[model samples]
Target: MRQRTGRLLGPLLVLLLVGAGPDGSGETVSLDGDRPGERLDVTLTRVVDPAGRADSERLVAVELRLENTGSVPYEDSPAPAAHLLDTAGQRFTGTAAATGAGPSLPDTVTLAPGDSASGFVTFRVPAGAGLAAVQFALDAGLGDDVGHWSLS
Candidate 1:
């Protein structure tokens, strides 16, 4: 009986995951100026699933494009401090990398005016947590200069 249940669960899980649809749709977000002369353009390209099995947590990688449109250069990185927001209002913190899988952002990115950078921000969320959007704080933990991308 136990063996039979296990066989059935595998297919059922696959079907459920398939029906969840592709990575969160791309969205554009404008970042605020942490200082008087800082502006940025952010685009959430897509949200991808982990290539390997997610036995513990569902680690999703968010692809993004960051452009500095301000006069001063962006002297900080956007990957290590990114966060994810789900439909249920739960927030998932971002990770530098997904253990051993997924892409990564640069360590020290300095985007000058008109310069742009593209990379991934990984987040570890609970399995099947309906992700609604991604939030980025330009100043890391400063809670200033924020940009939000709606996945829905």
Candidate 2:
């Protein structure tokens, strides 16, 4: 009976894995045209507001794509900081008081020439979290081009 159960689960797992497709990031992305040694090309995608549809408390996340097209590699501290500007223009992270807080995971990355990375910028929205615009700023290893986004 156990052997039969294992056989059934194997095919199911394979089917599930095969169905997951590539996310929107794919072959058609273009890096910002900046002079080498200038800055990283950051393309803001979406802001997942923590406030639920009803504006209750939930997890807020920002998503963007960062690519290094410069002559030298992007340089940053061991753990540089990412600041998220809430609707009120207050920083959500990296300030004395976390007006809004997000998961403090590793939250760091570096890119060699022509390297690109994508993921969500997660945070905790205050009780009165707004579901609109959130601005993001990167301290280092990034270019002058800032990222902007709006949630539904």
Residue range 1-152, candidate 1, lDDT tens digits: 00001112434621111111234345455565557677777776767866334677777888778888888988776765578888899988776674444457776668889999887878878787787767776766244545555565
Report, for every candidate in turn, its global Cα lDDT versus the true structure: 0.65, 0.42
Poorest lDDT segment (10 consecutive residues) of candidate 1: 1-10
| lDDT of the structure predicted as candidate 1 | 0.65
After superposing candidate 1 on the true structure, give the runs of residues whose Cα lies further than 4 Å from its correct spot. 1-24, 51-55, 98-102, 141-143
What is the total number of backbone clashes in candidate 2?
5
TM-score of each: 0.72, 0.51
99 Cα displacement, candidate 1 (Å): 7.3
The candidate 2 region of ten consecutive residues with least summed lDDT is 14-23
lDDT of 1 at 35: 79
